[model samples]
Target: MITPGQKIIQEWYKVKEWRQFPFQQEMEATYLAGYSGLLNAPTGSGKTFALFLPFLADFINKHPDYKTRKNNGLQMIWLTPLRALTNDIKKAMQEVCDDLQIPWKIATRTGDTSAAEKAALKKKLPEVLLTTPESLHLMLAQKEYPKIFQTLQVAVIDEWHELLGTKRGVQVELGLSRLKNLTPTLSKGEGANEQVVKDKVPRFYTTDALNWNANIDNAKQNRRQPTEAENVLWQFLRGKKIGYKFRRQHLVLRYIPDFICIEKKLIVEVDGGYHNDAEQQELDKYRENELIAQGYTIVRFTNNEVLTNPDNVLSKIKQILETKSNSLPEG
Candidate 1:
């Protein structure tokens, strides 16, 4: 079964006569689930639609009367590494909005944008704004700029790999930091005046009710139908047999690892044969990096390794738990 967002994407694909790829479907589902992760695919693999269509589907799902909606300021911001690419992205996105009858305003604010146009944009922000990192900084410098992005539902950094480990990449990070701080305003007497502090990096949350419930259902299903390797490993990890309680098919943030010991912040994953594929490897690496960034130590084993040598895997996990326990400060 697919989501309404997935169904909408399928209809758009039908218009283009293009078959939707599994990765694209997963990306849309993950986005709608309020999770953030990297999409590492080869060039010219419809990466743009894999990212952009979800934004549109999410909006439509949230606003049943989107055709009549007006003055929705800056629903999305697309930051590209090259100013030249901004125009192409804007045209593509604008065409889709027109086709869907979304009634969204798409505009570009780059180094080449005229001063008069910039002044006009300042007066009324578009629903979608595509700009470079430098222009984003310039926008940040403007007075009351947060108001322009207060309604923002999504932010995309295009060509992120190219911008990594460079001065421009640092600029993008700084610009995004400022943008993430601009959250929706609460009404008076509803914690409106309270200051809520956050970390520099964005945290994952199941922001939508439908998506949250779906994830809960998935986690429950996974627990019920445990893989052979997962069941083998769980034999030793369960019931505090390893001196620490482990949860099977546990949901952490937006990910469901095979097993997780909360006290040790350790996650164990048992991968099947499909994990050997190049594309799956890239996705696994990205997922691991995201988990590591959240301060979790991960240990992975192949299905064969877990099934054939459960004792070895158990010993390794025991050693990790002992080390982690010893390293903890006195409490």
Candidate 2:
């Protein structure tokens, strides 16, 4: 019989046109089996999803109405070395939640986050929070730290290798130690009762064990090659052509954009003949909805438009960028 977690995975793969890699499947199975250990996979090899999906599936299986449930403290905490990665991870996780129709909230508590956001977090925590080691230590120092982490089910440490043998790494260890003590029910070696198991310490996962070389190789294999239209648009937008840094074949959640300008929150898709098919159009619509939910402005151009009417395509992109830039609050 297929488990609830497996069913969710099957649906996700079908929607995304993705096949689970060997290591991803192994990690997912291990997580569902209620085992916790280091996950060794290449970066961008879907490690985040492998660790996140099964845990989410289990949560949903136990609480089918989790979307309607009130905030009950944080359910997951993600740690990473750089603050910049926080938003990227948040988008990825948020995409999954949105796709699954789960109402789980996600937030970031980094040094750069505003004071207002931090204050709000203290009153009620989001379901998932992406934070740095130092920020996590600060949270632990709060008077109600125990209450804050009472519902936490998992804690993922990204780029564990960078933290392993450093002072910050030691800080993470100390923080986890205190979190374990405060939430004894969730710690490992707990009793066999279901309630006891639920209260056990949050499962810990790290990328330290991943083979760097293998990760680089896998990234190469998965990288999307630009199409003719995409290549043409890149020539005009490459190297800050429009006064903004545009990334080509940028990965946003499960979909890779043909061109993305992060600063302008813009996504450009260069379409070919296949994009006009009814089924592909449905998939494209779904993809666009996801991006729009993330507050991105999407612009699409056909292969002929980019190749034949290149100037018009560039003008339209420039107009969107300027319009968005004008709406931003001045520094």
Predicted structure with the largest TM-score when compared to the true one: 2
**lDDT (0 to 1) per candidate:** 0.75, 0.73
Off by over 4 Å in 1: 184-331
Q: Give TM per candidate.
A: 0.56, 0.57
Q: Please give, for residues 234-292, the per-residue lDDT of candidate 1 as tens digits.
A: 88888998789899977776566889988888999998774664434544676688788
- lDDT of candidate 1? 0.75
Q: Residue-wise lDDT of candidate 2 within 132-217, one digit each (tens)? A: 87678677656667678878777788889987644346446656655655554346532212445444444332212122233333
Error of 2 at 118 (Å): 0.6
Question: What shift in Å separates residue 81 of candidate 1 from its native position after superposition?
Answer: 1.2
Q: Which window of ten consecutive residues has the lowest lDDT sum in model 1? A: 184-193
Considering only N, C-alpha and C atoms within 3 Å, which residue pairs clash in candidate 1? Answer: none
Residue pairs in candidate 2 whose N, alpha carbon or C atoms collide under 3 angstroms: 42-215, 185-199, 185-200, 186-199, 186-200, 186-201, 187-200, 187-201
Count the clashes in each prediction: 0, 8
